[model samples]
Structure formats: C-alpha cells, structure tokens
Target: MFKHFYGDNITEDMAMKFRNAAVALNVQISPAQVQGYLLLRKEDPQASIDDIATITYCK
Candidate 1:
C-alpha cells in the first residue's frame, strides 16, 4: 500500500489530491486505478501520467 512506501503519515487529503490530479489528467481514477498507479509507479517511474490515463480510460 501507499503507506508502505510513502509512509503512514500520508493524509487522506494528500491521497485525494493524487486521485484528483490523476482524474484531472483523464485517468479513470478509482481505487483500482490507485492500485495500478502504485504498481506502475514502482515499475516505471518515468511513465507518463497520460499513459496511465489512457489505459485507465480504455479499460
């Protein structure tokens, strides 16, 4: 979970901000998207946010 990497101090507001940002960029932001984002963020740190958005929307 995000707490594992980002630490337990990550507030709900911060999490929501990430969700909002991802959604604003066109990603179909959801709990599943959040999980995928965390995975992809680890595997490909340089991956484009838009790419995530595309995949989320297409799926």
Candidate 2:
C-alpha cells in the first residue's frame, strides 16, 4: 500500500519516517504495526504524520 501511494518507487526514507513516528507515539509498537498506519496516510493526506500516529492512541 505504501508502494501504491508513494508509487512503486517508495524509498527507505519514506517508510522510515512513518516507522519513527509510530515508535514516538507508542514505544511498544512494532515496525510492521506502524506500517499499517503509514498506509493510512495515503487515504488522508490532510493529516500530518504526527496526527496519523496519534490516531491509534486518540481513539
């Protein structure tokens, strides 16, 4: 999905930003779980990365 949004050219940097943000939101979360939320950004571009990370905690 990350590849679908960012294109087949998804980069390490792109995925890494989401991975880092997820960890910041929840120290216990795994990269795989974080990647799930990262895919969501493709659906809601209005939200910032921080906002995306906070979604799991907020709701």
Candidate 3:
C-alpha cells in the first residue's frame, strides 16, 4: 500500500518528518506505525501529515 506511493525508498528523513508531524498532532506513534500514516497520506495527498495523524491516531 505505502509502496504504491513511495516505492521502495522510504527514507529516514521521511520517517522523521512523519514522526514529527505525529508528535505535533499528539499521536502516540512508533517507527513501525509510520507506514500506516503514509497509507493515509496516499489516500489524501491534500492533507497535512499532522491532519492525517490526528484523524487516524488521535481519534
């Protein structure tokens, strides 16, 4: 799913940004959970990572 959008190039920088966004959104996320966020990002590219994290995790 995530690979459909990012291919096989998930970078540390990308993970870090997602983590930071999750943090700002007050979502308790681990490194492994980032793929789920990325999946949500793929579904709604117009959404900020913070918004995705909030809607998916902070519910």
lDDT against true structure, model 3: 0.53
Q: Which stretches of candidate 1 lie over 4 Å from their true place?
A: 1-7, 29-33, 40-59
Mind giving the per-residue lDDT tens digits that candidate 3 earns over 1-51? 333456556655555664466567674565455555566566543353446
lDDT value, residue 56 of candidate 2:
64
Q: What C-alpha lDDT values do all the predictions have?
A: 0.52, 0.54, 0.53
Model 3 spans with C-alpha error above 4 angstroms: 1-7, 28-54, 57-59
Clashing pairs in 2: none
In model 3, what is the error at residue 59, expressed in angstroms?
A: 7.1
User: What's the lDDT for residue 37 in model 2?
Assistant: 60
RMSD values for the candidates in order, in angstroms, are: 5.0, 4.4, 5.0
Clashes of each: 0, 0, 0
Candidate 2 lDDT over 1-59, as tens digits, reads 34445664556666566556656765565555545565656555334354754656431
Structural similarity to truth (TM-score) of each candidate:
0.38, 0.43, 0.39
lDDT top scorer? 2
TM-score of 1: 0.38
TM-score rank, highest first? 2, 3, 1
Q: Model 1 misses residue 54 by how many Å?
A: 10
Task: Provide the lDDT at 10 for model 3.
Answer: 62
